[model samples]
Target: MKGLVIGGGVAGLRAALDIANAGFDIYLVERDYSIGGRSAQITKSYPDLTNIKDVLKPLMEEVYNHERITLLTNSEVLGLEGEAGNFKVKIEKKPRYVPDGESCEKCIEVCPVEIPNEFNERLDKRKAIFVPFSYAIPDGCVIDETNCLHFKDGSCSRCKEVCDGINFDQKAETIEIDVGSVVVATGFDPFDPNLRPELAYDKYDGVITSLELERILDEDGPTGGKIIINGKEPKSVVFAHCIGSRDKKVENPYCSRICCMYTAKEAYMLREKLPNAEISACYIDMRAFGKGCEEFYEEVQKKQVLYRRGVAAEVYSNGVNLVLRAEDTLLSEPYESAADMIVLAVGVEPKEGSSELAENLGIKMDEYGFFVEKNMYDPVETEKEGIFLAGCCQGPKDITDSILQGGAAAAKAIGLMGRHSN
Candidate 1:
């Protein structure tokens, strides 16, 4: 009557902790080298501007230190069989190459291979052997075998020579376990703005996605939290909302549900950093539905951040500054706004491999690829008896809703397991 939770984001963490505290053994599986998920990558949470690390780090630590919880990083569920109350699961755990808790970081400084650091949204370069972030759970460096020279042609051993913790011989292992119920908390991926090429996301240095902006706002981030664009503070910054959401052109017509408020939050933070810099946002609509969110939007407006009704139609550089063209739906006038930096308020999408995972777990996915639930009233319960849904894997949602769903799923799992035991 054990429990299993997949995806180690905040939602997954909450599910695991809840089940563990309910006196059930639970296994938490994360596909990445670390377990923090997208929440760890963010600088702050909206409406209240709470430092995300303060919230995430303690939760991660509690999960890692919990006796009834087995934190499995760099792992994925390979298969699930049997029925509710007696499910067999197989997990594939990839080797990190660097031993956990034994990394001296000497390998990083000696490694010659440099690749774009995805953790920082490629704003900086990292050695082939590196950790995902400063506070990554199961803290240690991981070797990117794809880019490591030693794996290519055995051409480099600098990292191995500098650190005794590097283990080139380690291989992936498969673990089999039996659980009463499974919770799918695999999170969402930020909308790739490149899909909308007219915005010139890849064509200009001044353009960046909202997630990238989060990294830049992080003090521990690549630029040391400086709002520097092109090596200098910008005179103006403009945020464009609904890049991949609420648009029929991309087939993602659903509102992302968080972009408007987050954009407002980012604009508010930008005002704090660059008090004299002109700040404005172009949006299709203002949806501040969460608790305190509407008030926060008003606070941002008080900070002198201008909000206009429109969606960016096109973005191009005019040899000096990046120019954004849009139609102000409010005034029914075509306009162009030039800014030193343009942040795209990208939407959320289902995780790329969600469909495959749903099939593997014997659950249904909606047309949009989010895991289908039992009904609107029972949002956390999946169509499958032993399976439950949590977080954005079910659909687009903010952190607060994600956590609530996680707890609901955990309670469902615990009840099922308890009934089976009885």
Candidate 2:
């Protein structure tokens, strides 16, 4: 059977590889120029402590090489029609401007756009055209439309003027395909830290997200694994938990399963690299539920890392310092801590397009836009037969649970194919 998966994240990539291994033709679509979704932006995973791209590289290689799989990068599923056994998939693919499969390094060197990379949350800057990261799935440069000179009044095409491999005629194309099964695992987005004004996230130059901090601590990231913030090494760093997550009134009420583990891991990593700096994780009940999760958290606690059970009520600046005001529930008293930098373990919300895709396909999603299952026992199988939900698209889950869901999605997809007696 021919199947189409409309996401290139961990879960979608995992499903594509497994189902393709089962002898079915699979078409994998990714909106980004690369296949490894947000996970690609991270340096490592927690609890087990493994590099994210190291895991993605092998899976991506499989997706790239499988004879039964057709990979489409820099594309989005524009529309869906028909259902169940047969359907038409409409896709919109934007151009990379660079010639397909051509090695183009000079373009990046010559391009004039020098803005912070969105993928790494502004930790670093790359030219207008750049691989999302050094180890990006395709490992090639991409043309960012927003900053491209072609869109900015056509004044400079220095990249094109330098690159001998570009094609001026490369235009976006919308194509339609026929498929028997569909998988939607578009994943989730982090809550905007700026929305919570009391936190004064954007107002201050120091506060950042768990994702952004991950990049900063990464050896390959902008800071080269340094605990520096705003041009200086911070004497103290504080991680505030449940910033945009686990709070219904602010951003989301979801647990964002990966937060606790990441927070603990961040604390540990900070201690490993900055033994002299003060570190504390301000959280409301650390939810460490994965295998060896509790032990890892204990390890961070034993490192003289302060585990203050509390939610920071507000953050404001004081004479070149950021002040956190909150109640330390364990002490049952209000307290304030001055920190050089703040890391917000902002919660993960469903990726921006999850709902629009669900509504367009007539698939069921919860009030929050994650794929809603018909029953909890069958987590992968959604109300739409032959279509499965996996990863954070269903709810807050760590990488372990997401990988398990990936395998389960493959099993569910295979079972549906078997029912057709093809």
lDDT for every model? 0.92, 0.82
Runs in model 1 deviating more than 4 A are none
Model 2 ranges off by over 4 Å: none
Q: Residues 207-229, candidate 1, lDDT per residue (tens digit)?
A: 99999999999999999999989
lDDT of 2 by residue, 1-422 (tens): 68888788888988888888887888998888888887877777887678887888888877887899898888888878887767888988888877545556888888888998877788778788777766665666678887888777787787777877776568899999987778777888888988789998878879888898888888888888877888898888888998888888864777787888898988888888888989988889889888899998998899988988899889988887998888999999999889999899888888887877887677887877788976988888888777788888888777667778887888777767666646
Give the winner by lDDT.
Answer: 1
Worst 10 residues of 1 by lDDT: 98-107
Which numbered prediction scores highest in TM-score against the true structure?
1
